[model samples]
Target: MSEPRFVVVRNDEEQYSIWSADRELPPGWHDAGFTGTRAECLAHVDEVWTDMRPRSVREAAR
Candidate 1:
């Protein structure tokens, strides 16, 4: 069997996570236009999602 593929997804609050490429996405989340292996997906998230805080929290702070 082939290894599982993953897609990078982001929610309204700007949180990042990986989802199965073959499965339907959950509510309130959309694909970030990137697909790859689990590690690659995570690395993408790590590179982009530098702020761990939710969008609302970040906005409120600013």
Candidate 2:
């Protein structure tokens, strides 16, 4: 079997999630463009997804 591939995804609320590279992205969600093994993808999210709040909330704070 082939190795699993993962993609980091985010929604409008700024929630980060991992998705299968071979699976279809659901509506209203888009890829963050980070792809790799599950661990790598999660690490990417940890490095970049520092803020857990939604975009709107973050913007409001700014």
- Point to the candidate with the largest TM-score: 1
TM-score, per-candidate, Cα-based = 0.95, 0.85
* Best candidate, lDDT: 1
* lDDT score, candidate 2, position 56: 92
Off by over 4 Å in 1: none
Q: Give the per-residue lDDT digits (tens) of candidate 1, residues 1-62.
A: 97799999999999999999999999999999899999999999999999999999999998
Model 1 Cα shift for residue 60 (angstroms): 0.3
For all candidates in order, the CA lDDT equals 0.96, 0.92
**Tens digit of per-residue lDDT, candidate 2, span 4-50:** 99999999888899999999998878998899999999999999989
Residue pairs clashing, model 2: none
Q: What is the lDDT of candidate 2?
A: 0.92
